[model samples]
Target: MPESATYALDTRGERMDALEQYFREAARELREPGLALDADPDAVHRFLHLPAVRLQQHMLTPARYARHDDVLPSFVPAEASCAEWILAAEWLAYGDPGMTLASPGPALSTVVLRALADEAQQDWFFGRTSDWPTWAFFALTEPEKGSAATELTARLDADPSGEGWVLSGEKMYIGNGAHARVGVVFCRRATGPWGIEAVMVDTGDPGFHAETLPIIGLRGARISRLRFDGMRIPPERVLGRHRPRSRRGLQGALQAMLWFRPSVAAFALGVGRAACDYVLEQRPALAGAGRAEVDGMIDRLNRLRRLLRDVAAEIDAGSPNTFRVSGVKMRAARLAEDATLLAARLLGPASLVEHPWLDKAYRDVRAFEFMEGTGNIHRRGVFQGLLRDDYFTSRDRDVRPGRVAEGVV
Candidate 1:
């Protein structure tokens, strides 16, 4: 049998074991604060001193770029693998998805910075973040276009004053936008795909405005709408300016999104696991239909967890399978919804009122569908991959060549 087929949820080695232990403890500590954050997103700032939040602040920084003063906890690796990071994200999210998103750190912006920013730009970003618990945003999804790069209406044009560039447009559903001191905004410099470019923006700049949106789920994320009205961006702030135009804008965004898709899937899995754990814990002695339903949910959750771990390992191995990632993300999102719904049903109609944490989990899971990409979006990608016969290729390191493993997806 392929290793992926027999893969278990436990860590593979001592290093990952330690990481899992650290994050599990961190998640436990975050539960109360997470509930607090869900009630009031601003409460996140009060918990920045926590070790988990501090570790997350620098989790993605390369060792060479990381400052000695900003060193993560001794238990954390100087350079953690993608699998480790994904594992940490899942565990932290299991504690409280809202607080996990709300915690101050680079968040999604790290991916874009790594993919597109110059050395100096990276240094500046890391330095600022190291100075304090900084929040950064990746502004790509627009109000109307909804992250469709070709249809992006945001424009970046050369300034008439000739000192820099001017950015103008609106971006909606931007995580941490309302609180981020620094971020990268995607905009078009001219017609066609190559014209698209990403520019660094400081929130303090004139004409840069952000407002937290009223959202029903993941309240701690503080998803916001931003408007850039002739926001001046220095010429040097353009990301990947030294690279080919084709690789600078949408390509960089795509690379970041591809890298992040697995993490997003992991978030959903964490929520599903939380729901399952909640059900099992509260009703320790489930009978007949109740026990069967909980068992079925657990089975599905374990399969998805294996698939996610496999995908994360592939990413760490420098082989990202887009089709598998999309499929896992699609299925994981559904699993989160189903698991939470099952918990509610099994616990009965008054469960939401009686169990606040589970209720919060139910709401937070809804946002995972829209984060990174929507279910509809991923379904289309999976469908396309199937048509191209791209879905069956073995990207798993342990899988034999030309042999598709069962239940790995």
Candidate 2:
């Protein structure tokens, strides 16, 4: 690696620390002010700017790794697993999910670019991107297409003149749709309706329009609609042109799953953690050893956190085992819901819509179920990967990979 490349990798870690401290301070302020239940933008930005969180954001922040030009350890040291990434997210997210959403584009994009893009493209995507903040979303969702990565309408037409590609169609429920300068947009290419390709789209160009949709939860976070009006692309941005047969296309799809589903769980974890803390803080008597339900919640959360950490370690080591990560996603989202509901139940009817934390957390938790391929989609991803072993029963098999679970428990 060049001196600049080495330095950038080193700086990424440093930034993570700095961003982490920033969140610590923000959390401190929230507690002191007794703020309006996660409704502060300044606080959200502070949380976004945390060292751990900011590094997470910058990785995929560009015209799209989106660091575009930097080199990362093909395998992270044993010390830095996916857990470190998700764990840090867990902490910051606990304070505010709205704030925490920004960190992921970096983690997911960096991992994918390093794994997919060619050295030249990867170098440009990473090394050249401005430290100036760029937000991106995995724009695979469509109004008609929910969890199917293969079902998005955003079509990519690759110009055969050895020139570029054109992406047409739109995406909905896109996080950071309005402000995102670039995106990891998935499209059904013109080769066939069956031909699917994931391309990076620049929102600055003509024919590209993104309008954020109004959402009930995570109101501070930008969620929008994207319409690609004959969006043009150059050969340089072709992310998967040299698609490696074994893991290239499939892995990228899995990578998208890896980032968001657990994130859904992470979002839930934040609410659950806050809810538990709220319950413990509000009722001082439960400090005793025999906190059965509280202990159970803690146990479930700890296990899920461990799963996140272990799987992240695998991804960092360049040895991604989606089965393990998918399990974590399953457990995380479910337990998070249970954890939050437990708190709500313990707090009673008035607490369901109560002030400060519970009510907002309850709403945020709902988005987790729908975001990032949804719980049912992940269940399929997990089952497929695990059932690759074939020891599992055929009866559990879903119609389209797996079932789309609805009506959050």
Candidate 3:
């Protein structure tokens, strides 16, 4: 039997329910402070430490390896399905955006390392470390460079003796940037198709610097701007093969994002779901246009959730389905933004002035649009996929190997 079929667990739903309760309880105890968002940096650090420990104890490591048939080891979520992962993420997002925000840094780091790093490197980085949970992050966005890898300005220059490499650059909007023990920093090498290379940087290194950047939402998150004046690391710190003939570095980054984008959508979905639930509870009080808007948002959110599940199924079955992934991500971002706005509108002045939850959720949901890719970028990707022949025709429509022209026939 295939590995996907082999690992199917009948107990997944029960397990998820228990996990959800644990998360909800944790969120209640660790509820975000309203008055001063980032007031206590020490407290915010303490808040994440215990939860990280608990997650490690529960074997909640974001990515794990499983046998892909006895011949290959695959980075499938060892404890749950991709769909279940999304469900859990949704609850986390709803319960506490701050905790939800903390998760992606480690998760994204795991995904990128699994896809790019060698077996030895992966073990050394992700394997059992100290008693405390080891936090890691992926640093791709730069101070000046936008999302485009080709525009990467981070410098990765080799040492003259070839013993190591020196890194000098700044990364922006990096989650856990200030707190993470380790991070994968994407930089441009003088050589390479795109001059793109990813190097693992130790945040504790003397030359590495991190300053927290306060944001409108997810205030508890330790997002920071990382500056590497002269960070140095051994050659092994560089992930993937160095030889041009065997290069797969950038491709690995793309593959990693394909695995992660759904979780991004789930984060957005959770915010939207929270809005939907709140509005539904208040539906009796609402009349006319308010009620109709709530009804419309509920319908829209339900369809978006189903679309997310379908994309997750394809991922679980080991097909990344880039087109569907991009489509769902694009749709989910818009839906979350719209639903949160509508919910706030339905709640009237109370949402903004009297209560901070929905207002906070509104700001948090906006992060999804820029997380994996902006909505406009994903829309373009989805459109391009639709234009591909194989997306609908099963084969290239423009040129066929053995078929004659339809008009000639």
Q: Please name the candidate that would achieve the greatest TM-score relative to the true structure.
A: 1
Compose the digit string of candidate 3's lDDT tens values, residues 85-106. 6776666676655665554234
lDDT tens digits by residue: candidate 2, 264-373: 66657666777777788776677554257887788767756655655666666777666655666666777777877887777777886565467767777777767665
Model 3 bad stretches (over 4 Å): 1-42, 46-81, 103-105, 127-133, 191-194, 242-247, 282-284, 389-409
Off by over 4 Å in 2: 1-55, 58-81, 102-107, 127-129, 158-162, 190-194, 243-250, 287-291, 381-409
Rank order (by lDDT, best first): 1, 3, 2
Each model's lDDT: 0.82, 0.60, 0.66
> How displaced is residue 65 in candidate 3, in Å?
10
Give TM per candidate. Answer: 0.92, 0.75, 0.80
Task: Give the TM-score (vs. native) of candidate 3.
Answer: 0.80
RMSD of 2: 8.0
lDDT of 1: 0.82
